[model samples]
Target: MDLVGKVAYITGGSKGIGYGVAKKLLQAGMKVAISGRTLETVQQAAEKLGKTDKVLAIASDVSKHGDEKKAVAQILAKWGTLDVVLANAGVGHFAPIDEMSDAQWHAMINTNLNGVFHTLKASVEALKKSKGYYISLASLAGTNFFANGAGYNATKFGVVGFTQAAMLDLRQYDIKVSTIMPGSVATHFNDHEPSPEDAWKIQPEDIGDLVLNLLHMNPRTLPSKIEVRPTRPDKK
Candidate 1:
């Protein structure tokens, strides 16, 4: 598929991996609308990208039903069609299952799982119109459970299952779906600041490149699930 002139909507796009994907899509000549819960951050990122005409930044909380509607409405109003939807907005909460607070667990489930559902609910019509694509940013924890990561693992695991089933449901309409599961990405997730020590982890732009490749793949074939990791591990 031709990326140039295509339209994409990305959630949690103010910074980190989402920003990287937006930059790549803009570079590929795709018009992109990006959402963040904070207007200031979203505006700042949009301005820095210097593609005002091709980029729309909206303050949206994907976990909210109303916010999802507003976001999709804004994108549709701008581009008249949606060719891709990247449900990349997610948050992590780390704690032992026994020690996890209700707030922490709910936060993870709301953002990582419910948010994706809201995004798909809002954009499925436009996607049907364009026979577009849907991609979710899951994590290696989706399949690999770890100590102190119960909340995060549960949400991501649900995401992988949900995305896969949604893919099958949408295939009859020619709408493609895929989930990217990356291990140890150098992003400010779960309150972990990125640093040079993160060199061993996959870079945000690498995920961006991966998304571009997925978008360009032949229509007849769908590589529905992808797992990526750093080639080298940081030595202890």
Candidate 2:
């Protein structure tokens, strides 16, 4: 697909993986729209990308269907078409299931699971019109279970399942769907600061490049699920 002039919407794009994807798409000549719950951060991210003309910054809460709907509408209003949708907004809460609060559990479920649902639901019609692509950023936790990961694991697992089923359901319309499961990415997720020691892990731009590769693939071929991790872990 010719990326030039194509439009893409990315949720949680103010930082981390989503921001990296936005930068890559813009560099590929796509008109990119990035959303954050905070207007200031979204604007800052757009400015950082340094493509005011090609970038649209929207303040949107992916957990809310209304916000997603408005965001899609805004993107269509500005670009007149939508070609890609990246449901990348997610949160993680680690606690024993017994000790987890309702807020913690709900936050993960709402943003990680229902958030993807809302973003896709709001954009499906536009995607059908453009025969676009949809990708969700899941996590290694989606498949591998661990202690203190009940909430995060549930949501990521749900994301993987939902995206796979969505792939089947949307393919008839030529709207490709896929989920990327990445391990130990270097980002500010979970409110942790990235340090030089994290360089060995997956970089945000690596995921960006992965998304670019997927977009360029032949429409007849679909890699419905991808699992990626670092080749070399940080030595103890």
Candidate 3:
């Protein structure tokens, strides 16, 4: 697809993978809208991205349907049409099931799972109009469970299932859907700070490259589920 002028929306785009992907899409000549829970942060990112006509910043909480609906409406108002949606907003609260607080579990479910559904619901009609693409940022934990990760695991697993099922349901409309599961990405997720010592982990731009590849893939081919990992996890 020719990316010039094509408009894309990314949730949780203030930093990390979402921000990284926004940079890549803009570089490829696409107009990009990035949203976060805070307006100041998203605006700062948009300013850093430059191309004032091509970058839009929105304040949205993806877990809320109304917020996501308002966000999509703003995107349509600015760009006239939406060509892509990236459900990248997520949170992690790791603890043994017996010890995990109700707040932590619900936070994961509400943001990681319900957030994706809300984002897609708000954007699906616009996608049908453009026959566009929907991509979610899941994690390897979706498939591989580990101790103290039950809540996080359940939400990501739901995301993978949700995206795959949505792909089947949307294909007839020419709307493409896919989920990307990445391992050990270097980002400020769950309050972990990134530094030079984290070079061995997958960088956010690596995931951006994958998104670009998927966007440029043959229209007839649908890579609905992708599992990506660092080439050498043992290096560190």
- Top model by TM-score, which number? 2
What tens digits encode model 2's per-residue C-alpha lDDT throughout 101-122? 9999999999999999999999
- Expressed as tens digits, the lDDT of each residue in 1-236 for candidate 3 is 77899999999998999999999999999999999999999999999989989999999999899999999999999889999999999999998999999999999999999999999999999999999999999999999999999999999999999999999999999999999999999999999899987898899998889999999999999999999998887452
Go through the candidates in order and give the clash count of each.
Answer: 0, 0, 0
* Candidate 1 ranges with C-alpha deviation above 4 Å: none
Q: lDDT values of the candidates?
A: 0.93, 0.96, 0.96
What is the Cα-based lDDT of residue 206 in candidate 2?
95
lDDT of 1 by residue, 182-226 (tens): 998888877888999898999888999999999999999999999
Q: Is candidate 1 or candidate 3 better by lDDT?
A: 3
Candidate 2 C-alpha error for residue 71, in Å: 0.1
lDDT of 3: 0.96
